[model samples]
Target: MSLKSFGAKIFAKNIRKKIDKWASKPEATQKKVFQELIDKAKDTKFGKDHDFKNIKSYADFSKKVPVRDYEELRFYVDKMVAGEEDVLWPGKPLYYAKTSGTTSGAKYIPLTKDSMPSHINAARNAILCYIAETGNAKFVDGKMIFLQGSPEMEEKNGVKLGRLSGIVAHYVPSYLQKNRMPSWETNCIDDWETKVDAIVEETRNENMSVISGIPSWVQMYFEKLQQKTGKKVGELFPNFDLFIYGGVNYEPYRSKFENLIGRKVDSIELYPASEGFFAFQDKQTEKGMLLQLDSGMFYEFIKADEFFDENPKRLTVGEVEMGVNYVMLVSSNAGLWAYNIGDTVQFTSTNPYRVMVSGRIKHFISAFGEHVIAKEVEEAMQEATAATKARISEFTVAPQITPKNEELPYHEWFIEFEKEPEDLAKFSKTLDESLQKQNSYYFDLIEGKILQPLKISRVPENGFQQYMKSIGKLGGQNKLPRLANDRKIAEVLEKIIKA
Candidate 1:
């Protein structure tokens, strides 16, 4: 073995030992970690304001600080942006991760010195955990490319504003930085297409072993690399064996990715967000990602079905159960107090606390009283694709409210295909059938004639890309919403396809 690979294997073994000890007793470790996080942040501005001094327990914390969304915390965030200190956390934050907001144009989430380690350390540990579990440390020996957002951060007052991935890029460990691909200059290019081309030119000849990014963008990068080399990804980078991805579900793109790579590679999924790095795939045998309980964040869950209730039950890690969808609430050292980040997740295993992201709370379809979430839609699409042997590039669904005195409301699917199925009608039928089988409410709507059967509109190649570009959400961590309550995204897709 090469010296580099030998060193990586030794390093990975050490990390594995640490992880095994840390996660020895999951439940007890989580409770202790949560308490420690609370104690550390209790002296901060938010903690003091919320009477954190007297908050002795999880019950006290929950009762004191009510759950709040981004809009509710905007006042303090505005203060932070205006160069205020200790407004939320102690002193000032290192940077602010700008992200899309549900009720607002944008949200600037704080990234303080206290909270930065969670983002950086958790990401590092994720890879280390995977390496340990699979005994595959050679991935760290060769070049590893991360297709991140622009590293050109804009300064606001004294704070920096940029994508979370870009912010993390600046803090990559010195040792690993040697093997990291894409020059800082290339990553700083604001235009995604231009930056991608630059990245391909720079890294196509490197001894690349690991690639990390959102699957869609990474797919684009792989396609571009293939185009340049006229060879499959495996051939281009013979050592390529690890793919780390997040930002969206990987189910839809699994087949397409396998085909592009020419073989299956060990993969790890992460649940990193602008707010925090929550979880990561640790064990190859485990189905769900292992929650980062020791990360400097306290987590709470509100049952998604009862989230709109006058008073919903809030559960701590100790109280969460398996197989229930819950909207996440976080109290972190970043100064966020009982903040709702708007992502919904379901716990597949409660012993070690492994979770799968169910969907976004705001991104769902419930028109005609048929509540359909991202998980169901994605699974339905997976079934449809498998049954029809179709290859989907990208897709989004929106409710089509029937006109007044018109026939019936229905769901419209805007699908971009890499390879079209032999029969479009059969594909549409299989999709509808799969959804109906999964959601009883949807099945009832169609059976009762309250809604028409779902309709499929074949989007033109790169239709989603053009639409996202038009709306200034083309690249980086921005993801296409899988389901919309209205026709806003649907109309945009239609317009883009027509154009």
Candidate 2:
């Protein structure tokens, strides 16, 4: 084995031992983290405002600090942006993660000194965990590439500001610094198309052992490489054996990726966000990512269904149950107190606290009270894809309240197929059946003839690409939702559907 590979294995063994220690006592570890956060921030402005010193338990904390989303917490964030010290955390934030928000044009999520390592270390450990489990560290010796935003940052009140991924780019671990690729100049290119072209030229003839990014953007990179050389990614980079991905679920794009690579690669799933690095897939055979219990962030969960309802029951690490959908809440060392992070999750393994991100709390369809979620639609499509041997490029769903034929309102699906199925009718039928099995309210609505069976609108090849380009989010970590509550995306897709 090469020296790099041997070192990776040794490093991985030590990290795995540490992960196992905390993962085994999740509740206790989380409790410790919770107390540490409270103790550390007790003297900050937010703590003083929330009566943190008087807070003794979860009940006291909840009563003092109400959960707030970005918009709701913008008042305090605005103060920090203007260079306030000891306002939220102990001191000024180290970085501001610039992300596009729902109503607010741009959101600046604070990343403090203590909280930044949670992001860096969790990502590093994920690879280490993979290396330890598979006993394959050869990938560490070859070129590894992550398709991410430019590392360029602008300063606001002496705090560096950029996209979360871009900020993360500045912190590439020392060991893998030599192995990481696509050069600084190419990565700094602002326009994604130009940058990707540069990447293809630079790495086409090189050994690319590991590729990591959001699936959609990575697919674009894969396509660009294939177009240039007319060879599958696996053929071009035979040493490519590992794929690390985050931002969106990969199951929907698994078939397309497999076709592009012409084979399977061991993969790791990560659940990282600007709020905190929450989880990472530690075992190749596991169903979910292992929750980071000792990471300087305390977690709270409320049932997604009860989220809109007043006084919803909140559960801590020990109270969460398996397979129940919960809207995640975080109180972290970054000084966010009982903050709503928007994503919903379902615990797959409660013993060690492994979870699957189910959907976004805001991105749901309850138009007719059917209350459908992204997980339901994605899984339904997965089932249909498997049953019909279809290769889906991309897809999204929205409720069609006014049918063209003036028929009963129903859910309309827009699907882009890499390879069209032999039987579109059978595919649609299977999709409806799978959705019905998963959502009782949707099933009831269809059974009572209140809503029609879901319809599929075929999007021509590269339709999603055109749509994203029009929206100025063609590449990078941007991801279109799997489902939406209304027809906004559908309306836009309608005009941009490939002719």
**Most TM-score-accurate candidate:** 2
lDDT of each residue in 440-466, candidate 1, tens digit only: 999999999888888888899888889
Candidate 1, position 316, lDDT: 85
List pairs with backbone clashes in candidate 2: none
Tens-digit lDDT track of model 2 for 388-457:
8899889999999888777999999999999888799999999999999999999999999999999999
- Measured with C-alpha atoms, the lDDT of residue 62 in candidate 1 is 77
> Backbone collision count in every prediction?
0, 0
* Candidate 1: Cα lDDT at 103: 67
On the 0 to 100 scale, the lDDT of residue 121 in model 2 is 96
Off by over 4 Å in 1: 403-405
Q: What lDDT would each prediction earn against the true structure?
A: 0.86, 0.91
Report residue 34 deviation for candidate 2 (angstroms). Answer: 0.9
Cα RMSD for candidates in order: 1.8, 0.9
For model 2, what is the error of residue 280's alpha carbon versus the real structure, in angstroms, after optimal superposition? 0.4
